[model samples]
Target: MRFLRQSMIGVFLAAVSLGLLVYAAYVVQSAVQARLSDDAPAPPPRERVFAVHLERAEARTITPVMETFGEISSRRTLELRAAVAGRVTALHENFEDAGRVTQGEVLVRIDPSEMQAAVDRLSADLADAEAEIRDARRARDLAGAEQTAAEHQVSLREKAYNRQLDLAGRGVGSTAAVETAELQAAAARATVLARRQDVARAEARVDQAATRLLRQRIALTEARRTLADTAIEAPFSGTLSDTSVVEGRLVSANERLADLIDPNDLEVSFQVSTAQYARLLNPEGGLIDTRVLARLDVAGVDAQATGSLSRVSAGAGDGQTGRRVFARLTHASGFRPGDFVTLEIEEQPLPDVISLPASALGSDSTVLVNGEDNRLEVLAVTLLRRQGDQVLVRGEGLEGRDVVTTRTPLLGPGVSIRVLRQEAVVSAGVPDMLELSEERRARLVAFVKGTEHMPAETKERVLAQLAEREVPAQMVARIESRMGG
Candidate 1:
């Protein structure tokens, strides 16, 4: 009975200890939940402010420019062709591609031996004809002299017949003598008529010789002309291209030898949309002489020229949507045919217009302008022209106000903005020179040297820059951009 009572006491003590532990765990859980619910903070409100680039709108007269790509061409181009079939005997010292030639300069010489021989033969024939003409003239003179002698004999016979008739009439001569005198006069007259016919025949022979002489002279002149054609002379001062003829090369008549292009007389041919084409014309429906600047970027080198709008194509080309236009280049010294160039044509100036970055203009010609209290205001603008990265716009209440240069979807009317000033605009100064490594400098130098299409002057300038210890940052960036770096 004592052992059973001790067991009961131990069990009761174990149960009480278990209940106390469970109650302490429940109180700790409640205290932790209450602390959490009391310490958690509320969520903050969302901010509507956005950071953007901004530029002040200044209204002024802006001249819009239309940019287009074009190919350089020569207004005067000639195909040098052979006029006679012969072997090329001689070539000028500068008779090669890109060779400079003056007007009337003999560019190539064909074998003139054959043509010379023909000319000599024709000349000999002409001489022979001339000699024959002289001989015929002498013969004609001799025939005339014989006719004169025969006429004298006829006159003498007639006088004798008259005398015989008178003697017979006076009874101092016999009738037979008078009749014989009359017969003699008749025979003399027949001899005179034969001499006259001989003179006529001789004259006809002389005329025939003269005609033959004329024909022979004509033949000689033609042969001489052909001989002259053997020496191909430059029609005008130009540069030679597409040269195919060389010394000892046999060529046929009318074979193309080379192409001659007047480098000074160069033009740019480009195509523009119908609307742009219409804007390039004057009120008279003719192409306006708008000033144009053409630029060719060759291997990071820029070659520029100035010109004026010349004409428009007479007919639209097949598979082309726009009108073709041509500009007459005034100074095209470094330009060549087939060079693709960019042209910036000056259009009519717009009055009271604001020029801004293209990114500033939004859909439906709306722009975001910073309004009162630095809030964004959607302002409608009239987009006059889009030139490169800039747009010319005219709108009321835009002047003397700061307009956001860059737009984003998050930005809207009445939204607050934090202006991020652009260093490129705030400074508006020359770009700083950049320090380059030896490898980069060498690479640029090699690139400039390898650019065969670049103009010599531009290449030299670029090389000079590369030789310097530091190059302009902007220039380096431009070069790298062209190099696709």
Candidate 2:
């Protein structure tokens, strides 16, 4: 009976402990549920105080271009060399380093004494030659008179010989007398023949004298030309470069004195990778004439020059990865040869694509589509080209779609991004200062607001960019002024 009572007490105690444990578990469950209900995300704090930077879509023509590098060079590069050996007597006042000059301007004058002396000697010889010509004419006239007299004498002797022969044959006179008459006629004929020979000799002498005079005249003319070369004249209007010649400097014939360059005909030379060159080649396999731009880093002097592709080297250079190209600059002010510069040449424009900031495109081709949580969306885009500070993307929905103008490099696919100052970013992002359109404006605004969470300040900047984006006809006119039909 005592053992049964102890067992009952132990069983009662265990049942009470189990009931206490169940009650404690129910209380902890109630506390956890209340805590979860209290923490339910706080209702996504709405930052309507600061306006998000937004912009509308725009309808404007955008030129798709390719960019390349190049160097400045002058088209007219002349090596001023001495045409004749002489001491440089004078250099023009404009013959200084980088000095401008005019065509036909005498840049240098050699000591013309020797050339002048040669001219004088030639002139004297030419005069002597002329006098000899006159003498030759006089001699020719005398020979003509002698020749006429010899002809008449020969005629008379022939008649006399005929008479003597007849008399001897008829026996009308003594044989000795006829023989003597014949001998007399023969002697007369001999005399005429000797006189004719003298006349022929005189004619030949006249011709010799005339030929000598002609040769002398030619020598004189050559001397005169040499004398003129003593003074060096500028071939064209240009600037003088590498001018190391000084007055009184001895310059030998064919010696390099200096160089002349025409800045008006300036060119930009550059090298392009083989792939780039191939892209620029036309269908005929020749280099295409592409538009080019040059940027100079002069303080307050961001001047730009226009150019066209001239040619590319036929063969690749040794160990060079790209082909060499030359472009002719239309307006080349403040440009000089050997000036280290970077050129952004406009290559062929790609079609069926739109341009946007790299930041806007998310990783794996994802992009922010709509409403605040940065609705991550994917775009079926064909990446065409990448220019400095710009990218050309093409796709079915890309043309009319508003893309993020600028973004941080860290932006990736599915990553959240708050669009700030969309319109302002686009205008400020490129070399050109232009505004956005209504369509692009709305697109930009929607893109910015769609961010899951955006800072108030960022939203305001984005909105301000949208406001700046104006599809003003005035701005269009300004852009048109730079282009032509």
Candidate 3:
């Protein structure tokens, strides 16, 4: 009975296993049959079309602009220095930092008391020298008269000696008388010689006096110059900066007192890469006088000035790369020295070139142009110049073709694209207008009207635009972006 029961259980287990195998087979067969019976081929893979902004390439001559940062400075800046050391006794009312001064304006006065006293003393000494000179002349004249009298006496004595000798020879005069007359003549001649020596000494004295007078006059002139130097005067009309002197302050000779800057003689110094610098050069290898515009932002307002390229730095400055350039501004009304400014310099114009967004250029110096059937084709281009965010390129068959402004890695040659924005709609110079839905118009108008930071004139203009049948799409977009919608 136990064997029979075991056999029955085994048979039952086998039967259940067989039934499970059959049900699995049936499920697999039904699935296979269903898939095979559908007989529908898989649809061909569709190409993905990327939406991109496109700009039409139009060949024309365009002057590329190179933008750089620069510093504004004065071409004519003078350091105000004290020419003589003294204590500041007087100060001009406007002799301070940022003071406006005109030509020949006295800015400071060092204590002139000492200089004046020196000058007075020198003048007195000069006067004494002149008086001495006059006295020497009178003495010289008296010595000459004395010499003449002595000479006349000598002549009379000689004549008397000759007469006495003649008398002695003729036996009318004694030998003693002749000898005495001869001795008297000799004594008179000696007196004449002494007078001549006195005359020479007087002439020498006169020369000495003249020399002393000249030296004293020079000293007096120098003292007067020193006195003049005590008063500091402006050499030109300009503005003063960095003033350091004050009333009653002691200053040394050649001490820097302030800086005088000619606001009219303004210049901007900027640096550019070697490649860009080459573009600014003419065929003669000298820097061309390219037109430039300098802009300074002051309190949210732009101060613009026009200028021309002046010269290139003789050497690249220490710890810097590229070429340093200078530009002379024509009219710098609201600019000052050492102000940081923006410079836009016009480069040589490139003919038969198209200015495209920088992103349109590929890493391989190739650009993707729109081909037939909305496909993109890679074309080799020559890069002429780079103007800020744009690049100037020239290539064959690149004109009149739409270029993708913004490129992505997913986009490549032979890929399909959907032009999200056309050249006319996205152009910078033209105004893009479109009819807006009433709801959108109302929302934008409400957002613009509610903006407190917006100026009234701008707000009014925006409202007026919205009221028209067609409104500018850029303005609407800007308004919506501000609305956080």
Which parts of model 2 are misplaced by more than 4 Å? 1-63, 184-196, 284-290, 356-382, 393-485
Candidate 1: tens digits of C-alpha lDDT, residues 233-320: 9989999999997799999999999999999899999999999998888889998767999998666556789999888898779999
Computed on alpha carbons, the lDDT of every model, listed in order, comes to 0.89, 0.70, 0.88
Which stretches in model 3 have alpha-carbon errors above 4 Å?
A: 1-40, 45-54, 85-87, 141-196, 249-256, 371-375, 400-402, 416-421, 424-485
Model 1 steric clash pairs: none
TM-scores for the candidates? 0.73, 0.64, 0.71
| 203-268: candidate 3 lDDT, tens digit per residue | 999999999999999999999999999989999999899999889899999999999989889999
Residue 479, model 1: Cα distance from true site in angstroms: 4.5
Winner by TM-score: 1
Candidates 2 and 3 compared by TM-score, better number? 3
